[model samples]
Target: MTYTVNCSILLTELPLLERPAAAKAAGFDAVEFWWPFESSVPSDSETTAFERAITDAGVQLSGLNFNAGNMPGGDRGLVSWVGREGEFKDNIDVVAGIGERLGCTAFNALYGNRQEEFSPEEQDELAARNLAAAAEGVARIGGTVLLEPVSGAPRYPLLKAQHALDVIARVKAESGAQNIKLLADFYHLAVNGDDVAAVIEKHAKDFGHIQIADNPGRGAPGTGELPLGEWIARSRELGYDGYIGLEYKEPQETAFSWAIREHAAN
Candidate 1:
């Protein structure tokens, strides 16, 4: 039941290269992040520099996301989006390469928002195909593909745990690869009004990773109503021993007292 900080959400005031060090300073020995580069296929220099930053920070890289179109903008993901398959595929090798360098095995692949031009069936078909390919590519490095149900975007089809699991099953059956698993994010589940505890009890064994942010504000664990600490303990009771990613928003200079408290309590 160790913890890893998500630099993409925490420590936004610092430069990307410095975030790993910041997390380390905050008592975190591991961290995860979304795609840092704007380009799907960044140059070797950029990739190397990123790897160096993490290595020099002396923290383990726990998880990384495959390229999702424009995160800061409105794009939820790109792999399932029509006409963006090429770009999404182009990022697989890059992500896998970095994952190999960082000793990171968990990789999240976001299912893109629904497109009006494409029917639901078309999107599902495309997602399954692309996810299968992604699963295969990451398998070369002994990496696992993570499917997460995101909140706040209605157009995104995978908003419920069942939907994400269904997609994972489809990809596995279609690709004959078993490296795909679920990324259970409690905040997203609670935000969508699902019984988070019930979902965890049923799918804990299927989870490859877990992330958390409190409901109402998507902030730190203690900032909202979710009993994240209890939920985390429950997850461990159910046999999930993986890192719990702290994927929550925080002020630029806020202290991670909540994490310290949780660690002490555990």
Candidate 2:
């Protein structure tokens, strides 16, 4: 099985720039991250340090998020925010540069929440255009822009696979970009009441990427009742060959026993 540690969530005990090395030392050859900087356009010195961390650590940067503002502050993303479109657009070159430098090809774009000042139609329209722009920029590196259905944000409209797929279709039609795809995160889909099995059974072949955290607590797999091993095995049976991102929150030391348990069961 191919697995990549999501350093942004799992390695909270370490400083951000140190996470890729930590992940490499933990036996993972690949790692992923959310936007690693606060500013949309980080200085060259900052980016240079970041790239150095990954290269020195000998780890592949598997996936990254487009600048999603203040994720810990309840902001999901910037694409649909009417006043921040410039920031989102400007961040694309940085995201593309990172992807190209690291040979990373999958990028997630979390759709911004529904703003009170705008109608749903207004937000959706803005999202499609912005997502198309993101897709086009990433496409230059042979990358795919991912749309993920998130849980725990009431204002976020995408809570299921189809919701994201609809936006993917919209972006393709509007911009003639075919580089967009759904990021099927089982934990979010299950928490939001979607039939996760049916989703994987029907569309696993098309998923841009997959992420997992145990249900109920969003912890590592063994801490919850989710049949994650079976689901992942099934997804493999259905031809999803991409890395399964371990995007759970837990103590890094004991977090991966679940993988060993799942492997024994398989």
Clash counts for the predictions, in order: 0, 0
As a TM-score, model 1 comes out at: 0.97
| Candidate 2 off by > 4 Å | 260-266
lDDT, residue 26, candidate 1: 86
lDDT (0-100) at residue 41 of candidate 2?
A: 98
Q: After superposition, how far is residue 14 of candidate 2 from its true place, in Å?
A: 0.7
Error of 2 at 41 (Å): 0.6
Per-residue accuracy of model 1 over 141-223 as CA lDDT, tens digit each: 99999999999887888888998999988887888989999999999989987788998899887789999998789998889
Candidate 2, position 148, lDDT: 95
Give the candidate number with the greatest lDDT. 2
lDDT of 2 by residue, 20-93 (tens): 98888877899999999998999999999988999999999999999999998999999888889899999999
Give all TM-scores, in the order shown.
0.97, 0.97
Candidate 1 Cα misplacement greater than 4 A, ranges: 263-266
What residue pairs are clashing in model 2?
none
